[model samples]
Target: MLLPIALAVVALGACDTGGPQIPEPPGPEQPTTPSQPSTPQQPTTPTPPTTGTTGAAAPPGTIAYARGGAIRLVNADGSSDRALWQVPNASLAATIGGLAWRPDGTELAFSSDHEMATSWYERDIYVVSADGARLRRLTNAPALDALATFPKGTVTVRVQNLTGDAGPYFVYVLGAPAPQQVTIPAASSRALTFTNVADLGNVAQPVVVINGTNRWFGDAVADVQGGRSVDAGSLVVTAFGGIPHYGADVPFWRADGQRVGFIGSPTCNLMQVAATPPAGPSQSRLLDPAVFGATCAVDWGPTAATADQIVYVDERRFVDAGEVQFFRVAESARSAGSPLLTVGRYPRITDVRWLPDGSGFLFARTNDLLDQAVNIHEYVFATKAERQITNFTGSFVRQFSVSPDGQQIAFERVTDLKGPSDLWVVRRDGTGARLLVRDARAPAWNPRLR
Candidate 1:
């Protein structure tokens, strides 16, 4: 359960950097009072499962989402479009939220509704193949299941359940026959993790997608948690917990899947605390000294010299108002961060993300929207050059994610901030721009989308 809204945006805190660091200030640990509290009911009959196989091999990169009664997949170039699963009057949008692809690109998982549950938010979990075959329903429930994720280095995928009946909303990582349930109450929200999660996908680089609610929260799922995870062949910590992060939940699975980043105190600073996984009460420490009182936008980068570093936007108050500054730093050496060059005077940066290829990152300055309405830009670190990817008018690109191939980007655009939205994608250089799905909430690129 989430806390009250007013309590969520409060005073700044401290970070534990090993030796003698001050205790973290109590963050705004409030969950908003949901407008609609749902009723609890049992599951009606689930539609019979069906499996579709594609021996033709998925195109170099595939983009998929739950739509019009099925899971839809299309190429990055908008060619070869098809549905992996088709359910009459059922869709993943109701609960699953977005598309989660397996690491090997062999399977994909999402939440879909076959039966009308107590509320529209309640749905079931299903996994299908890259070719649309081996369709298996992973979960059957009477509660809400949203924000499904395939954490790197683990066999199981994590799913969220906003239970009715005042039951504790939990994050469950299912493997084999049973599920390892990690209940994250409104309290102890310092961090969240899944316990007993086994390996279901190829163990490449272990990463966990951390996302949350709030406006400036943006889409920073980046932040590499250093060391200790299932990917490392052992769990240094034990327990799993996290709060319900909404809207811009672009999952950043950093270093070994144990590291998770969170946003705090927007007024005092761009407050962020990196919670190391394995799940315990005291697991989270301030990533570094909370230098940037309101650290607005933050993205994680792997440094050859350092373990994991960050590029973030720090927003501060002036004599009369506020200001935003952009920087890149390794928390170990946080004495005055190395600043990144920007176009205008103090560009307002949000949704900072490293390109999949790691050459640079994509960010947006709402202030820039005045000259050019709603566009995505890339900042190349090697050359310190910024390039605009999307050139449009009057469209606010709310959230976006890059293809695993680093060739294309998917984003949600709307005329007004609260108006209806459509999902659009374009090439890295802004060549192929078109609409892929309409009225979509979260548009995530398949990890296998290369």
Candidate 2:
């Protein structure tokens, strides 16, 4: 159950104003002893809605979302509005975790309930067509399975059982069908080992996997451990977890797979691995530390491009005010090299994603610390501006996604603190706000394949 709004007042204290505050106006002049038996007060006039540069009508190619077991797409610009597809007996039990569109945009990959309970630990990977037709169950596992990426010819999934007694808790790769037990040796079970996988595609050919034993490569078990491997590209560098106490969620490879970036804990300094995998002994060097102050979350820009800028939130003030800060990763390794830019400082930065073109990204910001009313914001990089997309009074925006062309935005508008969440969408400019699907969490936009 979510805490009531009144509780937020006590939790955040009076000093922490979540949103804009309203000032009290001066009281009326002292009246002469209730003159004329207090004449009836006149009703205040209602304020007219202010229209921005974009009018009330939705922009061209606009989409609205609703929630009802599955993601429902509605053509707000037209009359056809209905459920895209139903996941049979899918329940709103567990929250949908993450979503991504295949390069071709014909299919969508997402993480949902792998286990039975509503807890975060129980989740599995599922895929569906763009039009909501042909729902496919990709992974049939009792443990938690998440679809990390579905690159054209192959799909990569991360399966783990933190609570299970079993020893095999790692990520696996599957090439369509046939060989279902394809496991990365670096990520194989070996007591308590930690591994992080990043995709560089075929350009770097072999994917980069950071494991506890040692960083090595090979498609098969023998090639990986025995060192019988071909040079996919240059050996950028090697990054090791710092202290290992804070856990591993740091290192990430750039979209182009040319450079690797990660955060070194204990010191929490931002470091970059410049070597391409499958090369000479891995070499590592520290990058800018100023941009990586107590980093909380980090995401690589889109691949297929050279823009190596990474966005992350500083942990310094995030503990109290939940502010989000953005930094641009430049080539220079100077001390004052990285510049920290402030995107928004209010509420909390929930999720951050980079646009395919590296132009800008969309992020989910919420104010419901105790689960009372959620506000969503769309941050545009080109204009260097942030706009409040959803203004649900007593609900929270669970998860959201942006269209392939970056025109439409879909999200789950969760009402009733203890109830299920529904899917909704609004124009990036805050127009044509409506419900598209119900009982859905993570929504991914399908790319328009040629």
Error of 2 at 332 (Å): 12
Instruction: For residues 230-312, write the lDDT of model 1, one tens digit per residue.
Output: 31221111122222221111223333223334332222222222222111111122244345444435655632332266666
- State the local distance difference test value for candidate 1: 0.41
Give Cα-based local distance difference scores for all models: 0.41, 0.38
Positional deviation of 118 in candidate 1, in angstroms? 15
Native-structure RMSD, model 1: 16.3
Q: TM-score of each candidate?
A: 0.49, 0.45
What is the Cα root-mean-square deviation between model 2 and the actual structure? Answer: 17.3
